[model samples]
Target: MDVTFGFLLLFVATFLVAGLVKGVTGMGLPTVAVGMLGSAVSPVTAAAMLVIPSLVTNVWQLLNGPSLGALLRRLWPMMLAILLGTVASTALLVEGDSRWSGMALGGALVAYAAYALLSPSTSVPGRWERPLAPLVGLVTGVLTGATGVFTLPAVPWLQSLRLPRDVLVQALGLAFTVSTVALALGLGRLGEFRLGQLGWSTAGIVPALVGMALGQAVRSRISQQRFRQFFLAFLILLGLELAIRALL
Candidate 1:
């Protein structure tokens, strides 16, 4: 794709908004960026663009949290499963029909948002976590390979673990960081990710970081519950638009 001025503007704007969402909520950067950009670019291209920014932000999120050693010890199975699942689905990364991918992306967003809105208090038992973690990771990896979004069962499953707030945030960062690297590897293997796109993807870091800072500032002053409700509602609208466009 040509690096037209308008495209650059849109790219920056998209990441800025996406970064803000992640800053406030501890996740959603890739989902929001890819969902918005998928309308204008192919899902493959959008996923490629998100590779660097997502990696950087998520790595930061991962490192800043508590007990990295413990988290990895407990979550390694799931992380490995995510990698294997992504590798298994690498072909889908390049061969997917854009329309179908769009619908898939939209469906993912809608499902995640709806679950967050309606689900009552829930928890995954300790024994169940041992058995269920890999399953969730594998499903999340396949979905990430196909749609460039990694928040479906992964996020919900994480929430159900009932970690403390900070630990949960760190866990999300670790999962997303793994997913981003796995997706990048899949894209690289298929030759869909190219050097030319790096310039734009790299440039996105500035806006994304700026947006995160602003969002963190706002997060301190506002009701997170209210903001989250608003965010989910916006996601529903965006998801519906993407789905409708795909069907048309």
Candidate 2:
């Protein structure tokens, strides 16, 4: 939109920091960036800027791991529901007023922050997966369509699948990749997906990869324990600000 060098710098730095978080903790790229950037830009703009970087990083995440065929076969039902819900809901979101989408994004941030702060390791029997996953996908898709954030029940539900840790991480990447692509299609249909934004989004990938390298190098020294809690607190504050901004 504005296309200022200063804003581009801010964008790069934000992704650098966000990518560091993802490298260290296996997530938070979009959440951290969107939460902070949303303070300066509209939620929709933040989402737009996130499009390509999100897609690329998540694709790397998905492909770097093994057993893609199995994860896809097993997870297809929920994934399909996610795509369906995204298409159905995002068309409305893209065409209607944006304030509601802004407010939705803010609320998603707040809810995610609070959940990360409070939730403990949880478990559900595998028996529940079939019945529960589609519901989770539907809700996650609707939220992603409206707000461009997609954690909440999806992450927890994935965890509940009792997948190995590596596979779980890859699963997240796969799901997020699907979400980002589906979102891009919706944005394109709405005529909000511009080539310039994609260019900037592509440029952001470099800083993100650099940050990922830095994070991996320093992972042993960083106290990932406290880092997460602090991140959640920061997000809570930012999310509140966004929600307030949306209301006003």
List RMSD in Å for every model shown: 2.6, 3.6
Q: Give per-residue CA lDDT, model 1, range 56-150, as digits (tens).
A: 98998899877789999999999988887886786776886657766876787787677767864557888899898999999988877776777
TM-score of every model?
0.87, 0.79
Per-residue accuracy of model 2 over 146-211 as CA lDDT, tens digit each: 767666557657755656655776798889888888888888888878887788778888888777
- Candidate 1 — worst ten consecutive residues by lDDT sum? 223-232
What local lDDT does model 2 show for residue 211?
78
Off by over 4 Å in 1: 98-116, 222-245
TM-score, prediction 2: 0.79
**Sliding window of 10 residues with minimal summed lDDT for model 2:** 219-228
